[model samples]
Target: MGKIKLTINNRVVEAEDGQTVLEVARENGIHIPTLCYLKDLTGTGACRVCQVEIEGARTLCAACVYPVREGLVVKTHSVRALEARKNVVELIVSNHSKDCLSCIRNTNCELQRLCQELGVREDAYAGNKTPSTFDEVSPGIVRDTSKCVLCGRCVAACKKIQGLGILGFMDRGFKTKVGPVYDRSFNDVNCMQCGQCINVCPVGALHEKEEIHDVINAINDPHKHVIVQT
Candidate 1:
């Protein structure tokens, strides 16, 4: 594709014609917070955290999916854009599980970082939360719906990277969730246990089963032969 010039946050930058606004911004050292946008995965625009203002556009556009065009003008951090992004993060956090203190992905979670960055309040916009499910039936992986942001990253990773298509969005609207078909346990499906979903999950929604206690118990057993392998 031919290179095109676009203005992001009042800064003119040249980018490929088909590149998304988020790509151009990042190439120019501009920061645009995003969720549900993973490199090499198809953009779903499921999360509006990357929304940006476009000149002459009636509504804010998701930078991750909005392709850059010649003379396109974008604002990644305008007051309007920042407020929208902050509100989006707030909604996600309001319904999210409040177990970060003990959650596996606490400090390293993308959602947690976004909350801190956007200054989202712990109790703002609080309302009914989706009924949660904790599925530990899978020996190697755990699925916690309470912390899911519905970002679709794990769904994309499982389908694209693993080609298993074992995971997907189920139900509709407020009742929607991601899981194997018919809400079946991962252990009941043909999952490869490759952990690609875990790798891409933005929150504590998906993680490997915790076995630290089991390992410690084994170590304390006098008759147990535990050989640590790196």
Candidate 2:
């Protein structure tokens, strides 16, 4: 197979034919932010966070799914690309809960980090907020739907990586959410509680329910009997 030569941010690079722009850029140290993109899985291009400017192209292309071609010129940080990335982050923030200070992924959440990086000062868009019912029902995992961005990372992690098929999308546009089959609670499905879904979540939607603070205090009591390494 012939190598496809392309320019990313003014640097020339060669990639094996048929590789997506994102795969080629990643291999060459070009950092492109993504929300719903995952390896070895289907790329839906729904997030629009990985959008980049391709010379002579009428519309911005999603680097995750757009195939690279010979003589293509790509600009990852153009003004138009910046505005699109900022709007995507703002739209996600409008529907998300502003509980980052007390959330488990305060420092590590990808969405939060992107908001800071992109300087998303205001969520100009109106929110389509929906109330959550899983707060008291979820046993092993804490599911805060208010914080969900519908990125589908957890859905892919559950069905593809772990072959669990426990979580998925329910409802339709604007009201769509990643959840267990038939809109059932996580406990209703055959969840293994392996926490793989939680690890891949970019937001605070999925989290461990156990309180580490209480667990640590219980173990520190000298007079009380404590189970070690259980």
Candidate 3:
């Protein structure tokens, strides 16, 4: 198409028309954090982590989905942007169980990592911490809706990349969740157990059911529960 001139983090850059602001920013080493943006996959913009303040826009736009336009001025990490991102992470954390130390992706989880980076000491919202059950029907993966941030990466991966539309975001608002139809188990659907959902999951919400934590605990337990998976 055509070339567009945009200012990213106050630096003028030339980007192709229709190119996502995230793409242009990354190309220029401007880190606009993203979770639901998997290259060559779907850009659902469900996660607001990549949000940037665009001049003349009424609200912050998702950089991964917002197209670059001529003479666009984008602020990647303004005070407003930081607060918005921090609030987004806090909202997700509010619903999630604060068992990060026991989680499989404890140290490696992207959501946890972002929380640390964003400096959110505790969730400020006094909302409901709705408890949900875990889904361990599959062998290689576990689904925990309580920890889901509604990033939609797993949904995109299953539907766009693997061509398996087994996962979807259900319900609305605070009750919204990602799962199969009728909130059924993934195994009940046509899932292939490819583990792409786990790969794309940013939090411990979706992960391989690993006994590594239990294994470590077993060293100190006189009667430890240790069941090896084959």
Candidate 4:
């Protein structure tokens, strides 16, 4: 694609045709907060945290999916854009589990970092949360629907990266969640237990089963020999 010039935050920059506004901004060191977007993965734009102001656009656009054009003007952190991002984070947090203190992905979670960045302090839109499902039947993995942000990263990784497509979104609206078909446990599915879904999950929705304590106990037992398996 040919190079095209665009103005981002009043700074003129050059980008190739077909590049999204978020890509150009990142290439130029302009920060645009995003959720549900991973490099080299298809952009879902499910999360509006990456919304930005675009000149002549009727509404704020998601930078991750908004294509850059010649002479396009974009604002990555305008007041409106920031407010929209904050509101989006707030809504996601409202329904999300509040056990961050004891959660596995507490400090490392993308959603938690976004909340801190967006200054989401209190529950702004608290209401009934989606009925959660906790599936630890799989020996190698645990699935928690409560912490899922429905970013679709795990589903994409399972299909695009692993080529298994074992995981998918179930139901609709407030009843939606990601899991194996028919609400089956991962153990009952064709899942490889490769943990690619866990790697791409932004929150604590998917994680490896806790085997550290078991390993520790075995190591402490004088008669038990712990065999490390890859």
TM-scores, all candidates, are: 0.97, 0.92, 0.86, 0.97
Give candidate 4 regions above 4 Å deviation.
Answer: none
For model 4, residues 99-207, the per-residue Cα lDDT tens digits are 8998999899999899889899999999999999899987799999899999999999999998999888899988888899988889899988999999999999999
The superposed Cα distance between candidate 1 and the true structure at residue 76, in angstroms, equals 0.7
Residues 147-227 of candidate 2 have per-residue lDDT tens digits of 887888888888888998888888887778778877677777798887878988888888989778887898898888878
Pull out the clashing pairs in model 3: none
lDDT for model 1, please. 0.91
- Kindly list the per-residue Cα lDDT of model 3 for residues 117-225, writing each as its tens digit: 8898976876787657588987677898878878888888898889878898788887788887778887788888898988888888888878677678886687876
Instruction: Tell me the lDDT of candidate 2.
Output: 0.85
Model 3 / residue 200 / CA error / Å: 0.8
Q: After superposition, how far is residue 214 of candidate 2 from its true place, in Å?
A: 3.5
Q: Estimate, for each residue in 134-211, the C-alpha lDDT of model 1 and write its tens digit.
A: 899988999999999999988999999999999999999888899888889999999989999999998899999989
- Candidate 3's C-alpha runs over 4 A off are 211-230
| Model 2 CA lDDT for position 21 | 91
Count of backbone clashes, every candidate in sequence: 0, 0, 0, 0
Best first by lDDT, ranked: 4, 1, 2, 3
